[model samples]
Target: MRCSCCQKELINSLTLQELFFSSSQRCYHCEQLFSKIDQAQVCPGCGRPNSTELCQDCCLWQQELGFVMRNFSLFSYNEGFRQWIETYKFMGDYRTRGAFVLELTEALQKYQEYLICPLPLSKERFEQRGFNQVRGCLDLTKRSYELLLKRSELAPQSEKSREERLQMKQPFELNVPIEKIRNQKVLLVDDVYTTGRTLFHGAELLYKSGAETVKSLTFAR
Candidate 1:
């Protein structure tokens, strides 16, 4: 299969997080520490440069896609990253959630007073996938992660075409109570941003809930 990162042909790769107990980066299990950066595109995890791509999800059905927002991804969805997602996403590797959150913390700390919210999983998807990948990243941040958006079980997003995903209407709402988020910077977290329909709907929901400025942070671009 094609890599989720560079969209290049993928080759298997090993990660520090997956090594034997002796090779553990261990950092993957701890809150990610920001290594400092001059701007947004450079990844703090690997310190790699020029790492930006619109993934397969973005290439299709981009009409309602908002261009004003910015996103920061932790790593390109290369073979190794794909495996990471698989292990944590499906095999009950919930411990990996902490590492992803640490990664997100270092990336999102720059935006102050932001509300951290996870992209919702349809009831069915949540049951099938077992855990929302967005939760993995949010655990590392000091900010409060509100269950603002919700997922619909009617049709699974994975089964839909990019256009179908884009056409998906607002299915999320604020589950945590907040009087006003107006003008407050809000960060919407998600495991990945393929078509971006999820994030767009999420940003709108935050705004409707009174968020002043809305920003998105993801593990991938």
Candidate 2:
């Protein structure tokens, strides 16, 4: 076996249970490059690490927008994660999508009853990138997801400053019929949670469209 990120031979021995029922695409060395957030020690609101209470961004969401969203994330957006994103997303290495499948699948088990919805890339961005990074990961899980929202082309979030991101107008519109969202519990999936602006924008739309509830999950925060 080999590590997906480093492409080095994986030397760890697997237990009988692991060999029979578990799969690991990333070796311990590569895995150690990124920090996994301990769910119990994270912020109740945005899942930011080391926070016993809601983080500042979450508090702002509640006070200013009158919106509260529970976002669960698996990893921190550390240097290693940034490099992975650069290769997989920006450099168009589609195979790297499988690296986090096991972790993502485990994290997603509790949201089985909710409709999985990957946040969209604009048509222009999709053409340029060749795939939606979020959808790429979800596809490997063989999890059914709805393309419920469509995004209009704007500057990429990576190019925007935090202030610009917060001030941006809504970029998403419903892609599916209102009946699909009406009264459904939605789990918005994304690659990362930056300032929570993008997720909140999508959640606001879901609420206006009559979704029973809207929460989010991301690979990183």
Candidate 3:
């Protein structure tokens, strides 16, 4: 057998867990395999392309945007994955989340010491969208959870340019006190991380809340 992405030959040492998790099918491996510090190919979480370092555009964007840190991921928010995410979270298509959760499980299996938090949608948005994509991912994973904050119903950051996104609004608020998160590691989960404003805001809330370190894993980055 061969890995679809990297074209590496399949090895018998690959357990059923590995095979299943790799398929976007395993709930356990989806929960565990996604939290690693490195990516076997693309990141199992955010799908950031190519290695530990950033691309030139990403570097400049990060510096200009004042984002402190960003992490890698698994699937790019291209057409196939994008449609799948939208359907699963917004359109009541749970199968897509189930499949992605299996993929997530395979990716996160070896990870530890990270508390997971789903990105929150404002109450109105939740009502409009019907479900939080992050919530579905969390429901599938067995990681610890912390609601470090609640996101407000701010203007669409995605519609704005980078400058506009930063200037638009405060983006998030800490419902969970800072005292509760001191010196802890946190792994933030989101359905997507395009432009990264949302994840950055979430990380800021956690950091201000006294988390020792924070990492993120989104379905798309």
Residues 1-221, candidate 1, lDDT per residue (tens digit)? 22222234323453444443322133322212223223455433222335454433344424344434556556565655666667778786776555444345556777767767678787877888777777755654666677766665347778989887876666775666667566667777776656556777777777677777777776754
Scanning candidate 3 in windows of ten residues, the lowest lDDT window is 29-38
Determine which window of 10 residues in candidate 2 has minimal summed lDDT.
Answer: 15-24
Ranking by TM-score: 2, 3, 1
The TM-score of predicted model 2 comes to: 0.87
Clashing pairs in 2: none
Q: Tens-digit lDDT track for model 3 on 149-190? A: 787657655677998776556667876766767898877777
Count clashing residue pairs in model 3. 21
Ranking by lDDT: 2, 3, 1
- How well does candidate 3 score on lDDT at residue 9? 48
lDDT of 3 at 58: 57
Among these predictions, the greatest lDDT belongs to: 2
The alpha-carbon lDDT assigned to residue 94 of candidate 3 equals: 51
Model 3: runs farther than 4 Å from truth? 1-22, 26-47, 61-67, 153-168
Compute the lDDT for candidate 2.
0.87
Weakest ten-residue segment in model 1 by summed lDDT:
28-37
